[model samples]
Target chain A: DVKVTQSSRYLVKRTGEKVFLECVQDMDHENMFWYRQDPGLGLRLIYFSYDVKMKEKGDIPEGYSVSREKKERFSLILESASTNQTSMYLCASGVGQGIVLTKNIQYFGAGTRLSVL
Target chain B: AQRVTQPEKLLSVFKGAPVELKCNYSYSGSPELFWYVQYSRQRLQLLLRHISRESIKGFTADLNKGETSFHLKKPFAQEEDSAMYYCALKDRGGKLIFGQGTELSVKP
Candidate 1:
């Protein structure tokens, strides 16, 4: 079974504080993604990394950055946490290939619910 | 631009009733569709993918390129089937665009 593990289940941070959400996948996937899951708004991609030391901005990448120094782990960083940033963060990993079959099928972490107070 | 849209926000039904969660997409190129489910207190997981053409937990979805839709269907929903469902589309860039999602509530 593919396992994607998030570092935190729930977190509380004050405004303007820097917050880090970590994720690790055991499947040796080459693609890792960070997304925020909000009610009504659904899941919006924040950032994604297709390879170690490489990253790409997703649809909603403002105020957020990502790091993938290692292939097995990806980290999402909020430079300045705000009230609007309080949401459930999800991490996903998938095979990085040119094809669309299993390459796009992602396995997700349990998610980290962060609250910016 | 590739986009995925789920028309329903919530669908409530009694146990053993039929269920259909509608999903639509817009993309110029070939789109790869997938269904992901999140159960209560559990992580989100892949339910099925269009290319696989398989049924999972009694639910099935057919990709209709002509209609630009991939609606998920189940003959009879069980109480355990209640959860949040999301439809996603994989664009040529290898990125995924997700739908708004539908919350399935199957009551006894």
Candidate 2:
């Protein structure tokens, strides 16, 4: 079974603080995604990395950025955390470029609930 | 326009009652749809996908191309089934666009 691990489960930070949320996958999948889960709005993509040092902006990526220095780890960075950024953040990884059907199957991590106060 | 739409914000039912969660999408070509569920304090996970054509935990969803809908159905609801359900569509770019979600609450 694939395992995706997020560094933190709950975090609290003051406004304008820099926050980092880390995610690591054991399966060495080529694709990694970051999303913020909100009530009534569901999961909105924030950023995704298909390879080391390569990143793509998702639907909502203005205040957030991501890092993929290594194949197994992806990190989400908030340049300046705001109260509105408080939400559950999820990390997922999927098989890369082999079988189209399996590539869409993403294994997820326990979300990090960040509270920007 | 939203790529995926799950009209209901919440659905409540009693145990043993049937349940249906509606999902619709707008796309021009072939579409790949999936249902995902997140239980309380648990990570979100995939429930089933359209191509699989297999029932999961007594839940089944049929993709209707004519209607552009893939609704999840379960013959009987259980307390363990209560969760936030999301319908997602795999776009041409390979990214998954998810619906707003439907919170299913099965009462005892």
Q: Which consecutive 10 residues in model 1 chain B have the weakest lDDT in total?
A: B89-98
DockQ of 1: 0.66
Model 1 residue runs over 4 Å out of place are: A98-102
User: What's the lDDT for all of these models?
Assistant: 0.92, 0.94
For model 2, what is the C-alpha lDDT against the true structure?
A: 0.94
- Candidate 2 residue spans exceeding 4 A from truth: A98-101
Residue B27 deviation, candidate 2, in Å? 0.8
In model 1, what lDDT does residue B64 have? 90
User: Model 2, range B1-108, lDDT digits (tens) per residue?
Assistant: 439999999999999999999999998888999999999988899999999998999999999999999999999999999999999999777889999999999999
Clashes of 2: 0
Interface RMSD of candidate 2, in Å, is 2.4
Question: Which tens-of-lDDT digit does each residue in B1-108 have in candidate 1?
Answer: 688899999999999999999999998867789999999999888899998999999999998999999999999999999999999998777777899999999999
True contacts kept of 2: 0.73
RMSD of each: 1.5, 1.5
Name the top lDDT candidate: 2
What is the DockQ (computed on Cα atoms) for candidate 2? 0.66
